[model samples]
Target: MPTPIPANARNPLRTFRFRIRMNTSAAGQYVAGVRTVSGLSVHVSPFEVWEGGNNLHRYAQPHKVNWEPIVMEQGLALDDTLERWALAVLEFARTGKAPGEAVKRDVFIDLWDGFAHPTEVPAPGPEARIRSFYVHNAWVSKYHALPKLDAMAGEVALLSLELTHEGWEPVPKPPASKPASPA
Candidate 1:
């Protein structure tokens, strides 16, 4: 009989342990207080072709590819990065003039394996990053600055931004280094 895995064994990386960096500044700072992120997806339309001689079937091939708009939400806070980006997009739409390179940004999402580190290892940082996705040339397509307020309810005000991007791809893992020989 096969040995059963222990209940205390580490589980796969959790979705809650990810970080989103807007890449808007030189430091590529993480977007603060992000509560949820969604719409990381891609689709490829199929082109169907039928052969005159064969009544058997129609061949389908890959056609145009599309990336879904990524949506990010967070509780309203003092940090105005999201708001600023949304304003830039609005300005472009109103003026009919591109805001140079300000309208577009490359966003990076990093996922970490929270339970992968050993006790001796330092706290999770860049080394703990297991996967990363790069959303290229993204621009804010929609922004919701304020959530409906109710006097009777107590809840944090949330804001959301929807970003349309050219496409997204997984960041390639760096090549492993070879062990050095003893001098």
Candidate 2:
């Protein structure tokens, strides 16, 4: 009998790190360790219909698609970049100022298949295979500042922002090239 390899054994792609880019205007604001991305998900509602009599087995029908909000966390910084970005949407919501064109921006979450590597401008390329997800028309819905501070050892202050987006789609990759025909 041959020895079977474990499912999670020696998988490089299993571990990944991600960074966020809030459109072109608010680019390069998110620092790697300062911010952590989470809660990028979608769910489909299951439709169930029950009538009188004839109960064999109940099957669920696929209903509307629901997209969950993307959550981001970061340590408090002096620049206050995230705080200002989130407040811009809040200001619009409160006074109906429309938030201008900058408010309606595309948010990109890029996943890199490895640990964090130091670079001036870290981007997805040959060295680190990256898969980016574009969240269309995103705006910060929730911005929670630092939680209750306590005199505890080794506690880091963190801020969180929840972004509500219309939809999320993966960045399209270029099609594979075809091999030349034999002469």
Worst 10 residues of 1 by lDDT: 116-125
> Which digits, one per residue and each the tens of the lDDT, describe model 1 over residues 27-140?
788777788889999999999998999978999999999899999988787467788889889989999887644899999988766564344332345556778899999999
Each model's lDDT comes to: 0.82, 0.70
For candidate 1, list the clashing residue pairs, or say none.
none
Q: Per-residue lDDT tens digits of candidate 2, residues 1-183? A: 999976534333643366666664644344444456777899999998765585876778999889998888887864466777787888888898865435666877766654434333434453443577888998888889876688875777888888888999998644545689899
Off by over 4 Å in 1: 1-10, 98-101, 115-125, 175-183
* Per-candidate TM-score against the hidden true structure: 0.81, 0.71
Candidate maximizing TM-score: 1
The alpha-carbon lDDT assigned to residue 156 of candidate 1 equals 87
Residue pair clashes in candidate 2: none
